[model samples]
Each structure stands twice: as C-alpha cells, then as structure tokens.
Target: MIESGFAKNLTGQNLSSHLGPVSGKGDVRVGFFWTKVQLRTKNPALNGKIVNRLCIAKQPIGDRYTVSHAYISQQDAARLYPQEFGIFTQYETAPANGTPLSDIPGVSRSEIGLLELHAITCVEDLLSLHPDQVSQIGMAASRVYKVAKGWQDKKDENEEILTAADVQAKAEEAIKAMEERLARLEANNTRLQAENDVLRHSASGHPAQSAAVTTAVQAAAAPGDDAPYEFPDDDGFMAGGDVVTGNDDLSDMPDPMKD
Candidate 1:
C-alpha cells in the first residue's frame, strides 16, 4: 500500500480519487495504466505472490490519501523496470507527434468516434486519408486541414521544447546499441585478422603447410561462402575489411576444425 501525505515527483498534486470499475472478485485485480496508479486499499487478493516494493505510489482516496502504502498493478510495476527509477512514467513524452483526434484543437469527442470509424484516427491519418473521404463523413476539408495543421504545429513546438537531457537520453540509447554492435564486430574482426595473420605466418616457412591451412580454411567456409562471418551471438553481419556484415545465414565448420 502507498503511504499517505504530501505528493512529490512527476505527479505533484493528490491523485484524483475516481471510483474505478471494480473487476471480478477484485481478487485478480488488473488494469493497464500508462503511469501506474496506486490503490489505497490492500485487499488480500492483491497482496502475497505478486508484490514489488517499487510499484507503491501515493494516491488520494475518498477524504484522505495514502502514499507509499498503496500498490500498483503488477504489469505496470514490470513496465517500470529496466529504466532508471525516480523518473516516473508520466515524465516520458509521446514517441510520436500525433495524438488522439479529440486532442486536436477543434475536434470534439463525438466527432472523434465518427472519424475513427472512417479510419481517420489522428492528424497523421489525415495525410493518408484524402480530404474527399473525410468530407464523406460530413466533415469539412478546411476543418480537417485546420486540425491536421494544428497537430503539426503542436508537434513542432513540443519537439523544440525537448530538453538537453531528452536529447542525451535518446543519444545514449543509440550509442549503447551501436557500442554493443561494434564490440561484436570488433571481436569478429580480431578473429578474422588472427586467421589472416596465421595464414601469412604459415606461408613464411611451411609452404606446404600454408597451402593445406588455406584449403582447410576455404573448406571451413563451405561452398560459395565468401568471407564467412555469422558470429555466434545472433548479431547481424558487419561487412568490410576482416569484419563482414549482412546476411544471417550460418554455415557449418569443416571436419578439420571439428576436432
């Protein structure tokens, strides 16, 4: 259960205490929360097996509120993991510019559903679905254009407001992914480089041995398998130099290497 008191973090004010739909025995409680909402109650069904200390959040209920004592959904708790904590899910912005049609400046809720039925879900959808099709739903082309333009402007404005931290975080993800890939490639490259070095070393003295090694190496590569890569880690191939990229096709090692 979430503890009671003054609020802090991403959610500054007391959480609105709306009586949510009670599902089942409230025993197997479940709901999908974008940012997990904590329940002030600690029903037995919600406790025991599916508990995580981090899922707890302060939320107002009835006259009073609880903080740290309330528990959130298990799925929500799991969702919050893998990323650094303290920064709650609420802080994250939408991945894309477009929002629900009702969120557009002049679009109303009732009209949103009607447009949704026509597959005109968001402003981005407007770009795909022609204005003529929207007009079929009795919506003016100018009005649709206005909402779409507003969403575009809003997206641009919000994009400009992105903090340096946001940019850095995105960069970090890209860099992390790149570093992991580069490390695998570097290792594969080193192995290939070592093999090439061995072939060169063998050629320096033992001409016959070098010839045998070359044949064995070529045989290990298999028929038509040029510059064999396919590292064991399931990483995609990295071509060029000793490190070859592209193609996930794995080939068998020759009988000589089987020993």
Candidate 2:
C-alpha cells in the first residue's frame, strides 16, 4: 500500500555526480533512500516546508540500462528485478553485530515491527535515521529514538567504568607483590647481620671459650652447620704433647714428677 503512491512522487535526478560513472557491467546499487520534496499544500505558509520520503532505485537492463540508472518504486523494483530485490532483502534482514531493537527499554515488539517496515533493523540503524525519516513512524518516533540513544550512552559509560576498575585492580596486585618481596629481603638481611656478629666475636675472644660458644651459636643459627671450619695456626698444643708458644719453641716449665 505504501508503494502504490510512489509513482505520484517519483522524480528524475542525475545520480552520476554522486554514484560515479556506471561500469560496463551495469553495476549499480539498489536500496531504500531518503529524498527531499517540497510540500504541495495550497497555503503559502506551508508550501515552503520540505519533507524526506523513502525511495528505491534499480539499474534497468538493455537499452534503458545503458542510461546508467533508473529510480523505481519498491513494488516495481521487486516485480521487475526480483533477484536484486531478494539480495537487498536478504542483506537487510541478515544478522548484524549491533544491539537489537528489542533490547532497548520502552521499545515494544510492535514498535520494532513498525521500524523494520522502514528498514531500521537495529539500534545503530535507528540512530542513523534522519529526524524527519524517523518521524515517519508517526507519534512514537521521538520517544523510541530518545530511549535508544540513552541506552547506548549508558552502555558506553558502564564500559568505561569497568575498564577503569580493572586497571586499578591490576595496579593493587603489583603493589602487593612488591611489598612481599621487600619484606623477604629485609628478613634475610637481619639474619645475615646476626651471623656476622657471632663470627666476629669468635675471631677476637679467648680460643677455648670462643670455640665452644661459636659451635653452639652456629649450630643453633644454621640447622645444617653449613658454616666453614676455621682453625688457628698458632694454637699451642702439638702432636708430641708439648706446648709451643708463638715463637715455635718448647715451654721452659718442667714436666710433672712420676713414681
């Protein structure tokens, strides 16, 4: 029924300037389009009002096809070029990646069906329609468009919030890992300093007392007693049961008497 009045409004125009020169294979696009038309009202005040109407065009075959382009009504295009029309319909109805019309708040199934009649299949498609083209859906156009736009804006904001939250979480994890590493390093340094103090005291103190204390401290500090063994070269006792001093000479004291 919409296509019945298309003939009354169809007007000729040059598409070559916009579509570029037609190829030898007669390749030209066919789809619904919005075109501006002056109002036919008798009132001078209303006569200047302009409106956009949806139109379909197809490139005809043979001699007329040689003309490069032809504008036709949707019904006529479907009747004359069924294959091209079928392809157009298939592409329009195909699954798209954008948010579906039904997903938006306040957009009912009946309203979605009405929008589909005008070739708007998704939120993005609906958003792209001109305000005048959108008004063709009658009184509900403004409400539907507002809701779809609002839904899209809200979705973008939520995504941004989530992205920021993820970044903060990763940063917190990195800081926690660094803190753990510093704590372990501090503990290792404290233990090393304690071992060094014990070793220094052993090297400077009396040999007999120091040896006993050193062995006890080392054994407690290191479970495996992994510290290196160190024996003083100047220690007095030797293999023959003689006491040798620093000069490597025997002691002058006489041996204890025997029976």
Candidate 3:
C-alpha cells in the first residue's frame, strides 16, 4: 500500500534552513537537490540565490497558500532528522482565479493543468508574470515564454471587441431605462384620460350638443305649430289694421269694399 505520509504542517512550508544549512558543506552531489532526504524545500534560492527566484516554481494558490516541495539532502540525511531520506510534498493543491488555458490560442488541457499545478491559471495571471518566474514551472522556459507572449498578442488584437462589448452593455442599459420611463408616461396618460372621462360625466354642462337636443325635445313635446314662430317681417305692424287685434274698435276690421 502507498503511504500518503503523515502531515506535520499540512501546509506546504519549507524547512531546509530550520534544519540547518544543506548547500555548502559536503561530498554531496554538486547539482543535486537535498529534497530526496525528505526535508521540505523552499524556493531553492531562499538562502541567497535571490536572482534564481524564477527557477523556483511557485504556484499562486489563491492570494494565500502554496503547495511547496520539500527535498531531502545528504546533509539532512546525515543529521538524522528523519529515520531515513525521503521527499515530503503537498499532494493536493488549492485553486485560484486564473484564465482557462483553453481560451488561449494554442494551450492544451495538459499544459493548462501543468500551469495550474503551480497556480498560474488565468491569462491575466500568466501574462503578468515575469518570463524568468514562468520558467520555473518546467518544460522549456522558452516555450512557456512564447506561449505567454502569443496569448498577450491575442488579447491585444481582440481589445476592440472587448471595448465594443462594454459599449453595447451600456447602451442596452440606457435603452432599458428609457423604455421604463416611456411605459410610466403611457400609464399616466391612460389614468389621466380615465379621470377626464369621469369628470366630463359628472360636470353640470357637459355635452353641449346633447343639452341642445334635450331642449329641442321639450319644445316639441309642448303644444306648438309645426312652423316656427316668425317675428313681423315688416315694421308696419302698427299701420296694418290686422296686425294689432287687441283693443281695436269695430272700425279695426279690414273691409274689402274700402280697397
């Protein structure tokens, strides 16, 4: 059975310095890592190789946490920290926000997974990184640099499209706001029209034509000649004997003999 190994810190902290210097003193293999002895390793250059920081593959695990590797050395083995020599490493790595490799022009899932193993997942993260730092993740440093450069170029080319998308989103929001305002105006207009109709019905002198018709009906119901009453066509009513029939004496009657 494979032993998952006992977890001390469980966190991927390197302890080579704490155990004592592993690099300077020995018959130890010249280019060998002390990792085989099971002492946790740091970014290899932690002691003094600050310039070699790029060679140290640090996976950005969120804003926090890193699954660091710990290698054992002959010095560590000789010191007898562990019963024997063995490498202790974090098996499971945590996740962070990085661009998908698939979105990149030529990156495959495997290469994407490789980058993730070190915590560089997104295009932004990948591009933001220094070429030297990217080199630590493995394969060939040149190829990684090439891929990152290519993706950066792709991003540059598509910048216009991104800008257009932002513009479109803002325009759509503005149109939606305008439509809502128009709808409110329409609703208010309809309500006002209804109120106007109610006021017309409740008014004392509404429908002038209808009131005229009603007056005509009442006049028709009253006893009256079909012909409309006419005023004196001439102003000679006073001179005509038939015009004023009121207090005329017997002499008021018209006589055909006189004509």
Where in model 2 is the C-alpha error above 4 Å? 1-92, 162-259
Model 3 whole-model lDDT (C-alpha atoms): 0.55
- How far is 29's C-alpha from truth in model 1 (Å)? 20
| Ordering by TM-score | 3, 2, 1
Clashes of 2: 0
How many steric clashes between backbone atoms does each model show? 18, 0, 15
lDDT of 1 by residue, 48-101 (tens): 222123335433333233334444554656565434232444553322234545
**Alpha-carbon local distance difference test for all models:** 0.55, 0.67, 0.55
Candidate 2 vs 3: which has more TM-score: 3
Better of 1 and 2 by TM-score: 2
User: Which should have the higher lDDT, number 2 or number 3?
Assistant: 2
Residue 125 C-alpha lDDT in model 2 = 91
RMSD of 2: 25.4
Q: Candidate 2 on 164-237: residue-level lDDT in tens?
A: 87677666666776788899999999999999999988777778787898888988787563555534557754
lDDT of 3 by residue, 1-259 (tens): 8779866873577554454433333322211221111123232222211111001122332312333444444464435533222332123233333454556666676787677667775667777778778777776434755877786787789999987876776666667767888999999999999999888876656578778878798887884555366346676644655565755544636544576
